[model samples]
Target: MSGFSIVNGIAEITDPAIYENWLDNEEFKAAVAADSSPERNAVKRLLIDFEADLARMVRDDRVQEQVVEVMTKYAAWDYVQHDPNAAGNGLEKLIEHFRNVPVVGEVSPPVVSVILDGEVACLMMRKPVPDPVVPDTTYEWNILTVFRVHNGKLAEHWSTFRKAVPGRDPLGD
Candidate 1:
């Protein structure tokens, strides 16, 4: 017979670092680099860059350099955005978007879900929500981001947002 135990109705994670390592691994990194479409690569870079920032939030802040680099790349891209916030090739809008996005000072790791179709990759992240009024507090959110790569750099990206409720409850319920 197999032994079983649960704490707070959740199984204790014996290897919590597994997910973290996977997110920061070379496999994902290589995939981002291999994305041939400029737009697609850009999207991958944004996430990669953000991943560093996120890790820093939980462990160290020096990773901001990588985040800045990613942001800079996004700023330089001359691509159209499907998001409503994006107006005219998106750099200014993206900057404004990040400025307005609330950042939790506390660690709130994201849960990533990936799906690939040909050259398009879709990544879904579920994490503590950003406070509606504060930039340093936590909330919950479900975000779906799509990227299309064409020559190693990102060429396009689109995102959808949903709010998350507390208590292990699923969002959109």
Candidate 2:
């Protein structure tokens, strides 16, 4: 097991593995859009795409062109990050932060649910954390990240995360 599974896409946010998963899976998309309007639905899709893009960058080379491409597609140039542990504001700071990190061995942490209101979207994730008291044991920690979107691109971000030890990024960095 890769310690990751989509849970049959409970909230229907997991995109497919190798194909145009979301677009071809009408039933799955409908599950996600079941109680939403067209506008809110669009925001939901954008957030999912952004999440998947970040995950892809993790599995691939962090310094490769994909970083810029993915960020450009989903983030505004004046992106603001509010994570206290993050180095500084602006997109490059965030990009540079991951440039030299070793390749991660696990997949991105699964997102439990996604919520959207107006122009703000929140991705709720149940993170896996090593149990401090019990060696080799892990626990699930709930983490919430909210983003303010502009023109369908993420502009500002806030996350519930603290710095981890070097090479110990729980979400695969």
Candidate 3:
């Protein structure tokens, strides 16, 4: 048996191997299955669809018709009501940004998780960071994007980033 510690009433697995194994355990499956909320399920499906669209874009290195399809199906037309970041204000602007901006480095597969009982969802991943000073040394950028869901569609989005750091506690110091 692996040891775990309770931190602020949440179980913290002490070992990576144990944690990985526990992901496939029956109890874990049961717990996941017990969450039967329709909204939660819809969000999960939407996230999956979005991830597939992202994968296609990354793989093809271009935003195609499928990207628009996914966006139209999973995200609201006016996703962000008011935002300084031009890319997030509307679906058309976002697609334009995707087409114009060059992805800096290899994008890792995203890990999607639910938050706030289907009201919010998060996609966490890391990507290689370009280092101008030390080109040889590898660096990674940690990114977490949260989306607010409304009527089974993505209504709002926000993101946070940490550059070239590993094991930097995302929860804060």
Top-scoring candidate (lDDT): 2
- Candidate 2, residues 1-173, lDDT tens digits: the string is 12223454344232334123333344543454334477777777777667766766766555466777777788787889886656577778666655645566345554556677778878765555788899999776666799998898889999876765655663434
Q: Report the backbone clash tally of model 1.
A: 22
lDDT of 3 by residue, 142-168 (tens): 556778888877788776633323333
- Candidate 2 Cα misplacement greater than 4 A, ranges: 1-30, 33-35, 100-102, 127-140, 164-173
Sorted by TM-score, highest first, which candidate order results?
A: 2, 3, 1
Clashes of each: 22, 0, 0
Q: Report the lDDT of model 2 for residue 100.
A: 44
Candidate 3: C-alpha lDDT? 0.52
Please provide TM-scores, in order, for all candidate models, with all chains considered together.
0.47, 0.68, 0.56
lDDT tens per residue, model 1, 37-116: 66545555555555545455334343333444555553345544665444335555555444443344434344344445
As a whole number from 0 to 100, the lDDT of residue 56 in candidate 2 is 60
Cα displacement (angstroms), candidate 2, residue 30, comes to 6.4
* Global lDDT of model 2: 0.63
